[model samples]
Target chain A: MSRTLFFTSLLYRSTTEHKRAIAEFCSNVKMCRLTEQVVFSDPYKISQYNRWTAPYLDEDAEAVRQDNDLKLEIAELKAKFCERAQALLHGDLHTSSVMVTRDSTRVIDPEFAFYGPMGFDIGAFLANLILAFFAQNGHSNGEDDRKAFKRYICQTIEETWSLFEQKFIALWNEHRDGSGEAYLPGIYNNPKVLQLAQKKYMADLFHDSLGFGAAKMIRRIVGVAHVEDFESISDPGKRAACERKALDFAKLLLKNRRSFVQIGGVVRAMRQVEE
Target chain B: MSRTLFFTSLLYRSTTEHKRAIAEFCSNVKMCRLTEQVVFSDPYKISQYNRWTAPYLDEDAEAVRQDNDLKLEIAELKAKFCERAQALLHGDLHTSSVMVTRDSTRVIDPEFAFYGPMGFDIGAFLANLILAFFAQNGHSNGEDDRKAFKRYICQTIEETWSLFEQKFIALWNEHRDGSGEAYLPGIYNNPKVLQLAQKKYMADLFHDSLGFGAAKMIRRIVGVAHVEDFESISDPGKRAACERKALDFAKLLLKNRRSFVQIGGVVRAMRQVEE
Candidate 1:
């Protein structure tokens, strides 16, 4: 089957093998009559990221280093999560994967999607938010505009998680009975059993989500294709200052991700600044 | 030799042994001899990080997923840099490290010091500046003050590198003759070779500085102790916004550290808001 892989050049570089695996997996998931088809899985064709064509998007040298570091971190997290729970993963998901048109918000590229862990998808989206903020900084011409942009991005991340969680729970609750019995049968039977199972599942998701989110956030800093917010600074010293800010955020996010249950906790953590 | 180790509550429990080795090596450098003499290098004083001392900082459950991902990424970066540079490093060195009681700036707190890579120290200090900016969202008390603080941090990182390069070179220039050949029948000549050797040595230093700096920046954000900038938002959505800004910075710093040479490159980099 022809399969496509979608990834951010700034964050990931996939091999032919990686792309094929994702394509094959997506094909399996799409063919699974038991799972819901609301989220369509399709292999997207990708054009090479030609540095010459994208002049302004030149990979900042420092940003590349940040990306390299970030990639290693993501690999570690993935290994840890795999060891903890053998859940399948969506592989990658974020604004880069989503497409918005007037009234619809659709999940587009599923090339990197797989059955690794549910939390991975959630974290990917959230991590992109951190990426987006810096990306926008280059375009934020005024202080007020920059502040507004910052607020918007933060709010979006919080809302996205809230929305995703609520939606996921709603699906789980609705499919509790024999309606969609093909995939999950006695999994949701008996109230007490269901409660215990659900809690454990949720807990797993929480831990995985936190870990995955951190990986995504930290990789951008030290991985190969560092973000523009710090790179575009034209002055090495100023860029270094910008990088320091990003590092602080990475520290806090990884440290506190587990404790943050409500959206407010996440918000509180993000608002912190270095003293 | 008597050695002392202090512990930080990092995600990964670090037992610094090689750090002692590096410290010993640095101590042996006659030109840069330490005033605080260590009588012995006993392994008994090695301290372990108290992993359970703090509560899970992620107050918001949803954000946990994102933070966890960041944690992995940070870990990876630190590992890569330490592995590549031959970890015998002075862990932390920033504006704070330059203890300025009056007009003089003296380096302090080699307590966190270990043998990793020289870049880790330089990068850690520089990365903190960007941390201050994003952390300003939560960590900084006032908006205007945060702005000023950010500016100062950025400037300091720039100046630190510039001054450091000059000082490092000056030190090499003055001390390379090996005590002027004891009984000099002619003018001393070894010093010139020592000075010449510095060029090659300094090039390696520059590379390490960039890589370690990238690691330092990523760890602060995604490691166990999350920064306050993103933590203080009270709204998960808002907080993530601040985090995004920080991540952007990390990406840039890590990517460009290698290519940049002078303070000017760093300053220009920090000033850039976008790609």
Candidate 2:
């Protein structure tokens, strides 16, 4: 009965049909099809679409399929992808989703928008940055110029999570007495319990974000999709080294996200891995 | 594109409206109003709808709100309720949901059916059994013993999960070569990996089931709804004692479901708590 108008630099194109489409075309379709196959399905098994640095990653990809514990971890993440509806997400938010300059940033082309885990959004953003970090070596021509850029990416990852946590907690505190039923004002209104509730909430979200982020990173290397950062490395031999590092770190992140209590620990691990 | 006819004991209403209705009316409608409160919300906060046996359960209910870990556990379960769509759950599966004859039993009115965690269904069934176990003392009169009936309920609970596990694994094994993407035939088709996958899946499911079952038990004790199992007991004091035992066991189950690997441990715990 009502019409709404909008003016913007981007057309996100949110479909009300998103959920049903996600359910219907999950095993098929376009971009969501990418998430369905690469992130959720193909990485766990030998699929024709799945490729790596070929001769280099043959064992790695096969190991992923064969490692029971690793496969178990991926299986849990896959279930979360299929089952949980925690938010409306930009399912593929790798380096391509953002248009950023010195002064402004615009997120565009969210054709994959659907109700998914909030962590998927957070993870995609963070994981892409991690991919950029891992791809740094492939970009090098025996120069340290990109060192500052790598540091900047790490700083951004750290600050992004830090600011996100602060803002999320602040909002929860502001709305503690509001209509939000997650932490009811009548029960968890007490300061100690309220803080405890927030801690656990953040901890779980952090782990989920890391896990999803890791999955995103792994898929780009081994699954059908390839990020330009590593793809443009030209020499398949050199690119394989950079990708192997990313894949290794991603596997670590996916399996051990629960052990990471803070963003700093993750950053430190990334730095150590890069070294 | 196609026409389908249905005539059966069950109605699978394939509605495009299922998700929205499930999300919107979750804690706010019909008999499901009970689930919205007891299992998902009220137990976390002090609400007018939440009532325990006044003099007996006052401290216990207060302790529940005060208990940080317990509240966190409940919140995680609530998140799963809000987020996870692991199966087509028969949501309101209390004692009231079941109808029995000598040989044939038919389950009627799956009005709360939706895509939800399988544990919620299993938990609801198991929790109702626990409720019956607790209520036996309240139903005790001076004359004949109801010990056999209580034993029967416990045996039923024990047999239920055991048979469910056996059948589920059997199905998984038979269908390991099918189109299921969770464990691909090429990778997880191996005997050792398939067995490992099943073991992990069942273990995780067992924990989830216990957590959900415990949540159901707690809500019945303190949330908006009271079951006929406890309601049939005329004496308040006796009912309170029975309810208190149930409440204690439920808290334990919710908090420590992971420590229990087998159904036998849960049965023993129930008996120990009763003692």
Candidate 3:
């Protein structure tokens, strides 16, 4: 997902051409408003479509509605989601959106694609992966506990973020002298200043990813649409328990995402919530 | 100018209507990109179009180019100017863009109008008033020092900001139950939470206006177009002295805009720069 976004970020409007072409590309799709309503808005409020494992998760869903701090954080994210056209995005990158084999990986269903924050796509993939990890307990039996599988998911989460950060920075360095309008070569060409800019850019992106990831997680659990990972659990009790863990961690992450400096902290927190 | 923006903010896309209409209106105009280039980007860099009172402001213009902190701050403002579609802006709201009489005030020449941060328009008007205040000395002779008129200009700057804040918030309170997408009625209906949300929104807008205002001032002096307030001075030395003061204050405001909480403090700072 990060690799996909790396290529997307490279496709910017050239300084010589008409900027309206790119601006129209972003606005014409209406993807920003769509994401704002579904991923950021409808979930937190009393929307007619919102549902969860009724009775089991009813209180949890109501609690989300009542949480003012969470609502405040979500509003900020919603504004950023609507405003920041950082790069082209997959728009709806979740577990089912990808096809993977032993050697190759392909992403599908880019109908929602538009120019938006790169973290949105990255966060969507991570959120689905975390949901899958939590749902493993429901699939576990006496013969197969799925403990090792959960650990593998955790490792994959960490690796995906680490690799994404490395590749994204490498691409930026490669294109430092390019025609990107955000950072001009004449001003940011100095190595020290370039480093400062990159540090600030990456830090902001990391927090955005975490915050969006948590929002995705919360919506799946208590919002209009439930993920198949939790739905496939069959037993409502077990499913609700797994969802509650994910929900707890997501709320914590969304409220205090800035306190998290790295991906490792997030994975460890996920583990702590599972216990 | 603020009253113009208050009305502009009222025109928003209804949730039931096609958002594409408003989105296209913004992108088609390409006002955001134009402002980003002229007001935010061109002034900070060595553009061919850029000019100043040559020989006199040679070092000052060079210092503007060399200030790494100023460049960094400008980059953030450029990104915001390009991204945040907060409301419909007058776009180029400098003093010349307005027509005023004893009985009526009318804003003209909205050719650059589009959906953007409200601060850009507010800042443009305020920046022009500040420039007019600074250029008063150059316009003065022994008999008419223009001291009273200078104070009047400062008073206008202060009143414009104060009135804008009050009227804008009053409109928000009146429309608390409206279809505005930024603050949902369900989530922000509580008096305490609504107050918090308004405070945060206004504060952010205030800082954004100051940053954009400072950028507008800098470009007028050092970028492609020079404001007539200074240009009308005729004597290059007098014009340069007035410009240098405006430029210095603009740089300070741009870099430290967040530290300012009220318009009164800003007016005081402007007077201090005159001394």
lDDT against the true structure, per candidate, is 0.43, 0.74, 0.80
Collision count for each candidate, in order? 157, 0, 0
TM-score versus the correct structure, for each prediction: 0.36, 0.87, 0.90
lDDT of 2 by residue, A1-275 (tens): 00000000001112122233334333322555457667867887879888898897889888878777777787677667655765556677666788989999777876776556667778988998999998888889778978999999999999888888886676566656654444556667678877887788789889999999998898889898888888889888889999988988999999899999999999999989888
The worst-scoring run of ten residues by lDDT in candidate 2 chain B lies at: B1-10
DockQ comparisons of all candidates to the true complex: 0.01, 0.36, 0.39
Give me the runs in candidate 1 sitting further than 4 Å from their true place: A1-76, A80-90, A134-142, A179-196, A228-237, B1-275
Model 3 pairs in collision: none
Locate the minimum summed-lDDT window of 10 residues in model 3 chain B. Answer: B10-19
Candidate 1 vs 3: which has more TM-score: 3
Consecutive 10-residue window with the lowest summed lDDT within model 1 chain B:
B35-44
Q: Listing candidates in order, what is each one's chain A TM-score?
A: 0.62, 0.86, 0.92
Ranking according to lDDT, highest score first: 3, 2, 1
Query: Judged by lDDT relative to the true structure, which candidate is superior, 1 or 3?
Result: 3
**Residues B13-100, model 1: lDDT tens digits:** 1112322233243332221111011100000011131111123322322232233232233323332332222334444565456666
Q: Which of candidates 1 and 3 is the stronger one according to DockQ?
A: 3
Once fitted onto the true fold, the runs of candidate 3 whose alpha carbons sit more than 4 angstroms away are: A1-11, A15-34, A137-146, B1-11, B15-18, B26-34, B139-146, B234-238
What's the true lDDT of residue B161 in model 3? 87
